[model samples]
Target: MSAQAHPPVVLYDTTLRDGSQSEDVLFSAEDKLRIAKRLDALGLDYIEGGWPGANPKDDDFFRQAKQLKLQKSRITAFGSTRRAGSKVEEDQVIKGLLGSGAQVITVFGKSWDLHVSRALGIPLAQNLELIFDTIRYLKRHVDEVFYDAEHFFDGYRRNPEYARQTLQAAYEGGADALVLCDTNGGTMVEDLRRMIGEVTDLGAPLGIHCHNDCELAVANSLAAVEAGVTHIQGTINGIGERCGNANLISIIPNLKFKMQRSLTLDDEDLTQLTAVSRFVNEMANRPTQKNQPYVGVSAFAHKGGIHVSAVLKDASTYEHISPDLVGNQQRVLVSEQAGRSNLIYKLEELGIEGVDAKDPRLTELLLDVKELEHQGYQFDGADASFQLRVWKALGELPNYFELLGFRVIDERRVRKDGQHPMGAEATVKMRVAGESVHLVAEGAGPVDALHKALSKALRRDYPMVTELKLEDFKVRILGNRKGTEATVRVLIEWYDGRCRWGTVGVSDHIIAASYDAMVEAVKYKLFKDKVKPV
Candidate 1:
């Protein structure tokens, strides 16, 4: 087929609707509004807000969506087909969907005969009426109506004749598009592609909605598009029930750059793919997966000497595509795996002078980094500590401050709110500017109390430390050691007004690991200021 053979594929983002089905994913009204704006900015064709009348939160989202003016993407309200044996006019769910201020309405119906008989407990004929009347009635009220044929691939496999009839009913009812849903999400890519090829002439524009149970959601979605499906439904970062739905972050770039097909997002919008992925992950408060396919932190990070050397020569050697094309940058990671050339490359990137490319000292530096990593000190996620290591390697690290001693007291007590909260108090003493400063503070946890006490002691001397706020704190257990005996690796992310950096520490005690990382964070801030004298 030629490039001009098919129209542009419409990207339908269900981050609010199906994405909420993901465990631990809860979006407030403000979060939904923010994500909707981001989808609009990404130039997605459709943004499916949560189903109306499902809950008060979804109701609030639709009410709030009315105030926001999206420039490009249209807001779509989702619902199911009219209830079994109920009038489309009297169906409260259908009415709720039309009352929703969205320009488009999507109603899912039973495509599989087993679902019609077992799930709905209704005959196949009545289910067909439900699909037709629901789409037909809503089409009059909404500008566009999409019918999601739930369990389409499985249904087609079981009873192809019955599945075609259901789709034909939707087509006759005037649905603008028919989205084939892999609700159970277990269909193979080849099976789904063959099924879609047979169903393309059902008298409506075709679409694909997939789940990642088999880890083939993206592949299956592309197969459908190749078979002339025009609409693709997915969630950002593939957040959904069970495994996940298709990940738009992967599909968008694949369609535009790899498949060389037309999509709603242009080249510039495509570059923001990583930023959008991180933005959504941040809003959900989920840790960004470093090893994810396209937009992950480690997607473009090169650690081995062979890979880094070749990448420096020509990035296309090991990389499939330019990382910057998807808003990610190449990283040269340092470890025992790195060669002398890698160390030289890193020294040049860091702008550190006097380090010869062939310096024998680099071998010791490399060994130290590898040993630290072996002890659960992860330098890849900790830029601040890594900088400290580089300075120590050159024997030029400054003595920022002298820690005298620190103590922490944690107690469990019932508060006035009738809640037994952990009461934590910490004392920190440090010598700064030739003066001994002692401070005490209390917090909800040992780490918080320690940070507060340390900040209080250094407030007058290092006023910039107050601007450094811990953004995220994570602890990973190392090796087979279990429970309290386990060695812990603590990674702390800190952000000043302009810049963000990570620090890491490792120890058998969690609190000790946290304190070590926190100290690195403070020292790095002070070091940057002394270098620039700002």
Candidate 2:
């Protein structure tokens, strides 16, 4: 199963267009341009910018995209066919596509007979005219024009002859590719494969665009490829309307490794896949799906004792491929389920040297970890906290500072306008270099005030602490049967410019948990910098 055995699949990314249709996903024109550059760097064949004339932002994106001069990817515009009974030249959708300033344009038209009658309120024969006229007109102006036979699978099933006629209309109009779309995402893989096989003799290159409502977009896309479709259309992380579009992130590795298909991106370029996925998530203001296949953090993470032992011996025992191929690394998670092998691997990964695996202290530390996990502590996402525990167990932890006491007070004040605003104040007392230091600070909340007060007390002796920045905070309640009395776990992420780390604390009190997590975050920063005890 060599890659050369199958024809190359072109990677068409629609993260800016189809992906934006997702709920809560709103990309500014600037965000689209930035993502386009990232997609270009990842070596995609086409980057669908967005629908010009739909909004000011999309129009602005196209105007700016022309200046990007992307190295590898061509900026593409997406829109619909001309409206019924309208001249192609007078159609605003068609006009927008021409003005988009894109080298390539993709136009989706009614392929299903039901959609032609109900959605567009037009005759099926006239819908074919729209598909043909739209692509034919655009092909004369653009370097390439693609026809998206929207709902082609449903259309083929309802009226097979009419569906083939729609494709033929686009082909007669000189479309570079007739892309079959599983727009509803309900088509089974076998049906899609058979239908695609029926259309290969249409004398035009074929492509596939699938959604994930059935959680089958990736599978269906692969099946289409196996049936001889060449072009693959998808978005990063599979974000789109409803469930999402097909995920190019997952599709690429499967195509190159499993399907034995050639790709324009060399092996080196493919390593950027994880980065591209995360960048899109960041720009979209969405959390990374840790369980996403191939590029997710948990994709290659081994958790159970047996899995960790086997993976350490030979990754192939559990993992299907080397994670590094996609720029992701294997992670061995430590939990109550961990064995000695898991602890040793984590210690080595943390760069804690000289601790013998057979040391009696190692057993003590493992027991402590199991007890703590039973008390609602999770070390998998809090590497800094786990490393600190290891150092404390080995009696190698440096005392950066000693906390003396802390107090927080929340108050509500009413203004003359009869509006009440709440505020919080904190007082912190600590010892550094045998000198007592005290500080008070005010913030919008108790945890924020506590953080300010602590930082204020430490800034004089350890000015480098000024570089520490809190990045994210998460809180989870364990055993919610107790309601407000439930033990809560707080996780805080910190960045000091050089690297990022997470620390965790668990307590029945939310404020206590947050303060403890904050303390660990600062301690980890000082420990990593190798600062001497003040």
Candidate 3:
């Protein structure tokens, strides 16, 4: 069916509810408000804020969300259907949903025959009654009531009649929509298509809520859409319980561009896709996947010599879709595997000209860098710092600072109690902007002392240094057999309030490697500030 013939597909976002189940994820009430507003702005039909009565954090969210008026999306309060024996008005969960002040309410009801008899300790008939009464009662308070038929796919296969009966109960009780959930996330596409077709034949407005355990959540959701389901429930980045929920990131593009469906939000401005994806990852404090479909850092990156050469001729030769189509720019990765074409691309991006791709000296330099990488220097992950280092090595960089000779000393004294080492001291000397500075600082470690000294020196020129803090520091040994003789690689991540960047350093000495990375981190901040001006 054509998109114009059908109603606009409703988007139910569960980032606030199910997304919190991702491992090590905890969002403060303030963060939830921020994400909720963004989702609302994106034109989602429903925002599942969480189970307010179950936790203080969700309760706070409902209370706080009441003060703000979201123009597009209806905030939804999610909970399970009332218990078999309890009245909907008497159940704490139903009471919480009523008090949440959400325009819509979603309640999950048992659909699998095994769950009804074994999990809830109720007969098939009582389970159906619970589903009916819960929806009937909720319809009284909320304008829109959605029933989540949990494990509907598995339950339908096990006992098709009982699953249909459960849905029948919700339909008879005045539910606005029935969401068929792939709770186990193990259903196949063909089966989901057939099952959704069966459910849609029941004559209620149907929605698909899928999880990614079998890695077919997106496919199954699409299948349901083809089978005439109008609503898609998912989370950004597919973050949720177990594997994750279906990813709206992947689904949104597919529906809008490929399937020719009309999205509730604008699809013409595709550039916002990457920005929105990155913004969500940053707010969640989760690292963006480097190879994640359209928005990943490496999604459009060309590294192979053959691929780069072909792309230089026609981007469509290697790219399935234009990078600009998704608001992402093409990146040519530099490595030992990269060719002269890749080098030229990198240089052009750096705004450096007059260097021929076939220059003998440039070719020799490229070979040397590749040899270094073959020995364990990774440039891709540290492009910003690597670019600066390359510019300095080529004598093309502007001279901003210099480092003077320095010494680190540690003294230990024997005590009557048989103590061996007492403490250590670190001293640093550096010349920046042609001015010499010397400072002594004590730290738990030599690397910490070096960071403190560098910060002290750069404080005068860059007042933004205070906002820059190291988010991560890692050291990896390049050679395993040499033990103490092995070279160490250090990576440091720095962040201001608005943005974050990473840099790397390598040396035989651990302290020296850390110092190198720290210097690059500072320089990167300064360079970006001067160029970008936030």
- Candidate closest to the true structure, highest TM-score: 2
lDDT of 3 by residue, 167-227 (tens): 9999999999899999999999999999888777789999999999999999999889989
Best by lDDT: 2
Error of 1 at 104 (Å): 1.7
Candidate 1 per-residue C-alpha lDDT over 1-534 given as tens digits, one digit per residue, 9 for 90 to 100: 444565888999999999989997888889999999999998999999989998999999999999888999999999999897679999999889988888799999999999899999998999999998888898888799999999999999999999999999999999999999999999998899999999887657999999999999999999999887999999999999999999999999998878888876888898899999999999888989999878999998888998888988899998999988899988888766777667777787788866886666777788888888878787788878988888877877777678998899999998798989788999988888778888899988999999998888887767888888989999899979788899999999999887899999899988889988988998898887774222
Model 3 stretches with alpha carbons more than 4 Å out: 5-7, 268-270, 398-424, 428-439, 454-471, 480-486, 494-501, 519-534
Model 3: which ten-residue window has the lowest total lDDT? Answer: 525-534
TM-score of each: 0.92, 0.96, 0.87
Residue ranges of candidate 2 with Cα displaced over 4 Å: 435-438
Provide the lowest-lDDT 10-residue window in model 1: 525-534
Kindly list the per-residue Cα lDDT of model 2 for residues 339-366, writing each as its tens digit: 8889989988987666787999999999
Model 1 spans > 4 angstroms off: 404-445, 479-485, 531-534
